[model samples]
Target: PVNRLDFGTSGLILFAKSAEIQAKLSKEIQEHRIERIYYAVVRGVPAAASGVISLPIANIDGNRRINEGGREAETFYRVIKAWQGYSLLEISLKTGRTHQIRIHLSYIGHPILGDLKYGVKSDFINRPALHAGKLDFQKSEFKIPELAAALPEDMAGLLEALQA
Candidate 1:
């Protein structure tokens, strides 16, 4: 996959028509020219309105965790909205490591809702309440059309209930 989201994550997954494009895009991603934003409903309200998580991640027993041996992964997140016990976050990643967002959020005691692999399970939904909200490649050489995906119904509904 040229770009990927976690298995239970729903939204845009970029695909390159050929390996050459894939290579170019990979380099662009590495240079931090690609813009990817995500949305997730988490277990608790963050104390601050926004903050950056600069945690290195290492895969241990098939799970990603914060470790010194891992590469630097940075995730910027802001509380979009909040209700008792939960908060919606708009997140952007500076490094694309497997489960980077999930790991960072979970480490902060705010695991994504229904993300059983990380922690906390919500019968409110079966899968992790995460969505790849947007993609921006405006600065890249490629003319790939920009993508902006809406939140899935299940997640949207969950937000509604929380708001209520």
Candidate 2:
């Protein structure tokens, strides 16, 4: 696979027709030529409408944590909508470290809804209220059009409930 999504996170996974193509696509990802966009419902609203979360993450004892000496990771997020106790966010990744989104959002005190490991469990959804909404390859040499995936039923239902 060209990229991966965390176990409970729903998203797009790129695959190659051959090993050679896989290597090339992997290189593109490593060079930050591909853009990944996500939609997430968080527990609370952020203080800012949009901002970047530049923090390093390290896997300690099988759990990801924010550590000063860890590998550099960056996540960008903008509040798309806010409700009484929840906010919808449009998120992008500058670096894709394991569990980067979950950790960063939790660190900022607005963990994704239903992300039990990073945040409190939710009654709205069974898994993290996150979805890989779009994969943009405009910057890459490959002439493929952008790819997008709609939110799964569970996430869509959660959003509907939140909106009401």
- Pick the TM-score winner: 2
Q: Across residues 1-164, which tens digit of lDDT does each residue of candidate 1 receive? A: 67888899999888888999899988887787788989999999999999999999998787689999988999999999888999999999889899999999999999998899885788678899999988888878878677899999999888887677
Best-fitting candidate, measured by lDDT? 2
- Which residue pairs come into collision in candidate 2? none
True-structure lDDT of candidate 1:
0.89
In model 1, the clashing pairs are none
TM-score of each: 0.93, 0.97
Q: On a 0 to 1 TM-score scale, where does candidate 1 land against the true structure? A: 0.93
